[model samples]
Target: LHLPAPTDPLLRALHDILRTDPADNRSLDDHGRRIGASARTLSRRLRDDLGLTYPQWRTQIRLHHALILLADGTPVTTVAHHCGWSSASTFIDVFRRTFGHTPGTRPTT
Candidate 1:
């Protein structure tokens, strides 16, 4: 999705949180609170600035982290837990959807 250029402070803080620790396990609400905004405002800012829900952005970051960990030979369960996924199955599902195969299998796409 093409996003509007944003100079919103909340958006900037969200970007920093995502960038600082792609694997930060904090929930969206916690992240928003850390930056002194309401969750609703944070969500709206993300949608406005990045054309994505906060969860969507966080999931993308998690998938990237998963791929990196897989490439580094980290166990799948370990990676899932580290990335704050509720379970390995959720991680596998997201990995398959994102990479078109299971984690640790070299992505052909």
Candidate 2:
């Protein structure tokens, strides 16, 4: 989750919003209104600054939070809900796809 600081003010604002609630599943249009930008502008800014679409960036945010919650020994189902996945199975699928292993199987520090 070592993200580069966004140079654009709007992108920074968006990042702050997402960081505050990685579980937020708002549409780009909704988020744009919150940050005082159009969806297109926000999307372009994200691409320019982070080389990611809104969905991609949000997924990273969710995954970062998921890792932290898992490290704290939260149950997978609760973590999935806390991170905005529709269900534990969906979260597990995404987690497995992203990290090549399920969250429950992550090595301890």
> Candidate 1 at 85: error in angstroms?
1.1
lDDT of 2: 0.89
Local error of candidate 1 at 71, Å? 1.5
Screening candidate 2 with a backbone cut-off below 3 angstroms (N, C-alpha, C), the clashing residue pairs are: none
TM-score of 1: 0.77
Candidate number achieving the greatest lDDT relative to the actual structure:
2
Q: Which whole-number lDDT from 0 to 100 does residue 91 have in model 2?
A: 97
Stretches off by above 4 angstroms in model 2 are 1-4, 107-109
Candidate 1 global lDDT: 0.77
lDDT of 2 by residue, 1-109 (tens): 5556688999889889888888889999998998899999999998999898888888888999899999999999999999999999999999999888888895456
Each candidate: RMSD: 3.3, 1.9
Which ranges in model 1 have alpha carbons more than 4 Å from their true place? 1-8, 19-25
